[model samples]
Target chain A: GAGVSQSPRYKVAKRGQDVALRCDPISGHVSLFWYQQALGQGPEFLTYFQNEAQLDKSGLPSDRFFAERPEGSVSTLKIQRTQQEDSAVYLCASSLGAIIRSKNIQYFGAGTRLSVL
Target chain B: DQQVKQNSPSLSVQEGRISILNCDYTNSMFDYFLWYKKYPAEGPTFLISISSIKDKNEDGRFTVFLNKSAKHLSLHIVPSQPGDSAVYFCAAQHNAGGTSYGKLTFGQGTILTVHP
Candidate 1:
């Protein structure tokens, strides 16, 4: 794809229900990122990946929030027992990975709007 | 704590005028800063970026100014058009040694309304 792609443009889940969001990054992009954007707020970092390696997961809000980019391509963010506070937009981005003396600009997907009822 | 902050939630500007969006950060570890423009129902698009080494960077009609000493940055758009109305976000990048090392800290965002 020409840009990063995300699935389920919108998701409505009841409280306590589990939901999964998928992201398809640009081909051959070595770095991928996940972020959560609440209403009226900027995208907050959730996690990052360098290829298949889960190099960063500290941004995950809770133990129930999990993300994996297995095989260094497609990634999934799963939230267990969703709550009302989880209502927000989930964004996925990809970059060219770390480069010496260069800025790493990320390309973003349209994002999935998750509304936990 | 919020490392990046956009104090103004919204700003209105006339078309053909310059729109200046301001941002402040607390972390001195940030090596790079970027500005992103976002429309409703769409993801943010990279606008312009500046490195800590330089104080200014310009691209087309957009220019970014960074003041490392004050931990402040601003984006200036000349001849603002109605189509330029959207949310503008400021982001700072930090690459340290940790699991979430190379992450971007973003501001709360500023909504710009350009009137024709």
Candidate 2:
């Protein structure tokens, strides 16, 4: 793909329901990131991946939030027992290289807006 | 605590005028800073960036000025256009090492409205 892609642009889930969001990063990109953006706020970091390795997960809000990039090209973010507080836009981004590299500019997807009612 | 802060929630400017947006950070470990512009229903688009080694960086009309001593940074858009109207966010990254390498700490966005 020419840019990062996210699926199910909008989702409506009931409280306590589990939901999964998908992200497809640009081809050959080696690094990927996930962020959560609440209403009227900037996007906050969630997790990061370097190929198939999940190098960072400290930003995950709670045990209910989980993410995986099994094949490295596509990633999935799953939220278990979603609550109203989980309502936010989930964003996915990918970079050409690791942050230590000078060319590590992140490109973002349209993101999935999840509304937990 | 908010590691990054953009005190102004919104700014309005006439087309062709300069639009200056300010940001502040408390963490000294941030070695890279970036600005992102976002439109409604779309994800943020990368605008410009600067490394801590330099105090200023410019790309066409977009310029980012970093004052390391004050822990402040500002983005100046020369001859702003109506198309530039959107929410702008300031983001900082810690690339020194460790698991925090790629994590971006972002400030609350500032909505900019450039009127024609």
lDDT of 2 by residue, A1-115 (tens): 8899999999999999999999999999988999999999889999999999999998899999999999988999999999999999999999987545458889999999999
Off by over 4 Å in 1: A100-103, B97-101
Residues B19-42 of candidate 1: C-alpha lDDT, one tens digit per residue: 999999998889888999999899
lDDT of candidate 1 over A1-117, digit per residue (tens): 999999999999999999999999999888899999999899999999999999888789999899998899999999999999999999999988756525567999999999999
Candidate 2, superposed: residue stretches over 4 Å from native: A98-101
Please give the range of 10 consecutive residues that has the lowest summed lDDT in model 2 chain B: B94-103
Candidate 2's DockQ: 0.79
lDDT of 2 at B64: 98
